[model samples]
Target: MGPSTIPAAVDAAAERFGDTEAVVDGEVRLTYRDLRTRVRQVAAAFAAAGLKTGDRVAICAPNTWHWVVAALGASYAGGILVPLNTRFTAAEMQDVISRSDAAALVVATDFLGRNRLAELEELGGVPEFVLTIEDWAFTDEVDAAPVRADDISDILFTSGTTGRSKGAMSAHRQALAVAAAWADCGAVVTGDRYLVINPFFHSFGYKAGILVCLLTGATLVPQAVFDVARTIELVEQERITILPGPPTIYQTLLAQPGCDTLRLAVTGAAPVPVTLAERMQKRFGTVLTAYGLTEAVVATMCRPDDDAETVSHTSGRATADFEVKIADTGEILLRGPNVMIGYLDDAAATAEAIDADGWLHTGDVGVLDERGYLTITDRLKDMYVSGGFNVYPAEVEQALARLDGVTESAVIGIPDDRMGEVGKAFVVSTRLLSTEDVIEHCRVLLANFKVPRQVEFRAALPRNASGKVLKVVLRKESP
Candidate 1:
């Protein structure tokens, strides 16, 4: 048979890996058999509650077994699952719920308590049906449902690194393609246990972390939050074979007291600074970088067998099923089954993002090296013209991040009458540093035009739930 949909994977695992542990929390453990049963029951319940095909169902919660079960249930019931970031403000939360026209919301009682639900209900546009994780489980009756490959599976909203948020609509076939690509690239096999630190709310988290577990019969160990010490404990205890996280996560875990038992570690979300990969390899023996987004799922990932230089320097070779190229203007364009259909309810963005040739304009500046490795230079939106020269913020930010006493940095174009626009920097640091410090650092590695004209200190740069720096917010408040 061809590849199965997300629900079909649950069915196959239910029989093949029945008694094996599929999900594990600190004190809670569930076998595949039980997990599948819960998913079916939840699907039945959601169906009985008037959820229909193509309806949008939103889930706002942290990493937990319930998140996986609810998401799969929605997929099985032929509804579009919308995973909302838990860190969103009340306004942000309402905005997404309204924009997506979600018909129902499945939230965790602990995460989106009664007060938040009341607040969300008060918002004029939300769908009437709302159920907490606890309530959904306790329901007395539910009905059965099924899904097809082309059915819409999820709507993942991403606030462009510089623009307003847009929901990327992913179908079941596309979601399944991600799992297939990940397995082929990483050589993932049945029985491999993946530690899931990234939240399931993200497309990367759902497709790479949870769906991989379902398709490959791998076990999933879920964590509520990223605690370096706790992750080490789980890794050693669970003997987690595959780990996908950002460089910051790996860095923190490498610093943890007992981080020796991991077999494979994949880092992404932000650039994996060269030095960070070296430290991880020296400490844990397995370190690789992954590059992906909410729109295209996982387009590229470094293999575990790759050398430190490859892991540190490149985002990794493009996925086997995907095509990557540098547009004339340096933007990264992708063509593959992994690319989402389009942004939901936003025709303008859909037209702007995809062209007649079917390539999804990723809008991230990148270079395809002679070896076929892809190195992301910066966000196309984040690239600014300084004195008529194109300046990439990632290059300047990386240089500044490497400076002594600099914790994090962001570069943006600020108005300048003489030069038209010039680079300005916002820094988060503890030690005293000046604009000269950042300017000198960039001078050593970058052109004079790319260096920051001014540097300002802040306690910490504004970041979204996924820990991505919000340059959009930064530019708004710049002096």
Candidate 2:
């Protein structure tokens, strides 16, 4: 049997693929052995700074070798990793740090011309042991911690329906299993160079992108930001084979000058047209579609041999040994080892999410054909995907509530050509308000993706019989 724990998996990768290239960042390339050595060095530094077993360590940085090293080092030190979105404001970052009760924080100071550490400190969210990614002085190596399969590995936060972010907890074994399952479905193997365009803060990036590279011995090329020109340049320069992201990524890449080096393309955060899938098949030899959330890292995937119709029309059959079913209300249900243990420190919410019989309610409506293939139809929640990031309407509405003169607001997602969808907010304000005024206020409190692009003035929001805002009505009339 292979290593189950992530730390052991890292060591095993070094032993098996010692001389193979492991990571390719700008001017810094490391073999599996060198990567393991650096990971242990950072792990020793974390230990010297007083990180105890099972303590929470939060990382707020962009996608780079620094992020991979820090995240793995925290795991080596037996810390439950809490990844924070780099796009979030200082106050928003504080909310997650306080909610997760992280004992330590590692932030990047040079990203986007902002000193994040000082900002967080100014906001009073700096934790016990704080370190900057640009400067790590410790060089001593320490032994990797003895982590069990059932031990909690990470607590990734996802926005909830009630304007709060909920942390979903997953064990070390589940994380590894889900990654391996995704690798198998996507046909990722040794010697393949994967350009990870997905942000490291999300599961699709951390669990699927990072762990898949660790397990399969594929070289990881981290893209800090998604740029069409730079991504193609990396594809040619690094000889990238596997690239996985949302549909928007492929649509942009397909329009660029041809680069036939791409071998596999995995996509799904938004709807993928059949024409796009066929075009992908011609460009990349293999294309696969997957369905997952923060709760389940990878629940379903299309196989390499599957046709374009199967790959495009449905999210494909369930992977990761998951049992897929549909509830009476049409919500997709999943029961498997990869399913998250529960939400962090919220038993009531956990029970509500996963039923007494153990099936997890996905809050996504889908249908299962006779072949057990799952096709996502619509979302039961009012959440929408913008540039592959989930934008919860309630969360945006809450931000609008703080704006002066805004009495009531309803947020909906409108389809866009570039981005799969963008937010459209309808405001009922006391005084006259301009679209720029409402958007400028949200820019300070929320992430760039969460800020509404379009705003409309309304005398009063449409309400239902229960006095709840009729978001469906607002969506239908979305601009």
Candidate 3:
């Protein structure tokens, strides 16, 4: 209902928790006062670097307080923060930066440089200034001016499974609305320690972890990468109350030798297997299954106070201030203030995604029950045709997840001269699962056409920051 920019919100939190630890990353610990000061310094540096209001600054980093500092500083200086996927190639990075007309970039020193950053330096259309997290130096004189809620705070790119990524411009008001919906209704309390395993380059990580911590005055435990043993230890050591991650993350953490310290485990991005959810609740605590998209930041979250049955089955109820509807085609469309201001610089996509009535067409197909809980069955774009029979990848992947050795699976439609388009599976398993075993498992549940024509086993499947299986990466890696 009101403006909630990063600077204003952090200023409030600093006043309340100045001496308290606001962030912990390995050996580094920053208090609320220290974070506030650094954010202002970065804002001042951006201003000194000749950045103006509404300019875009891309961030390619992991889950560090530096990423938060850069993002919050950009918001404070009235610049649009564009988060670049750390997995992307140099060409991909150049395309996004050039397309967004980014004035500068704050990149990770060694994490994302190996792929294509060196090539980006040689190529034209580079950002005016490139600063790394370790080498960034900022002054004390930053003129913190008031910013309008209508100003675009960040541009998160989500171009779907295919094609180039589109920058989803999110405003200060929308970001705050998402945070408020979660805090007011989803039970994220102040002083709650949120273990952020997801990368800050993603909308899920930015809104769910960083913004939520800032809004609730929660301490942020920023882990650079997801390691089951380390994550569990952090939860026990820090007494982390809120653990937000993906299905794969939950599966791995639950399998860890010792991980019973978490008070609440919140999962999203992919559907959670009912069996895994049950096991988590029976062993650990309640593991709520939530569903959301980059378009809306986070549309639905399974409340922390929900019963085991509710948390295990549905994506829980819509948060306060949002409406979820099941379209005639079983598509999930959302209407809310948390929805983004359409795709950046793409009017046609903006028109297609957000309708005239302000509903966001979330490209996910699912249903809403009598109790108003939503269940995402499949992704509309991930559905493919095989021998005139329609096949949903989620269906096949779900079946694969049930197998004993299968840790993760990704299904895609590869070219098949015989069947036109045949289903192919790339799987990651704890132990090597034979192709015959995977095929037989799928054959038992799905129709012949829906079953994967070929099953390939890998030590680990490619995944994005949100833990969503990277079908594109899988397709590329497949022989």
Instruction: Tell me the tens digit of each residue's lDDT in model 2 across 65-156.
Output: 98999999999999999999999989889999999999999899989887888888898858989878888666699999989989999999
**Superposed model 2: Cα runs more than 4 Å off:** none
RMSD of 2: 1.2
TM-score of each: 0.78, 0.98, 0.78
Tell me the tens digit of each residue's lDDT in model 3 across 297-387: 7677676566666776788778747899988988899997778888877898889889999989877888888889887776668766564
Best by TM-score: 2
In angstroms, the error of model 1 at 390 is 21
Candidates, ranked, TM-score? 2, 3, 1
Candidates ranked, most accurate by lDDT first: 2, 1, 3
lDDT-best of 1 and 3? 1
lDDT of each: 0.77, 0.90, 0.76
Q: What's the CA error at residue 385 for candidate 2, in Å?
A: 1.0
Q: Which segments of candidate 3 are over 4 A away from where they belong?
A: 1-3, 112-116, 251-260, 282-284, 383-479
Candidate 3: 10-residue stretch with minimal lDDT: 111-120
* Residue-wise C-alpha lDDT for candidate 1, range 1-479, written one tens digit per residue: 53557777777888888888888876768899888778877777778778888889999878988898889888777788998877655456788888898888887656533355655666655567887866655444243356778878889987654335689988888898887788767776777788988778876678888888777778899888777678777888988888877565676677666656666787754455678778877776667666677778888878767788898788888883888989899989988877888998888888888888879898789898887788887666876655434466776777787888998888898877444468999988879988787778777655466678988889988989999998889888986
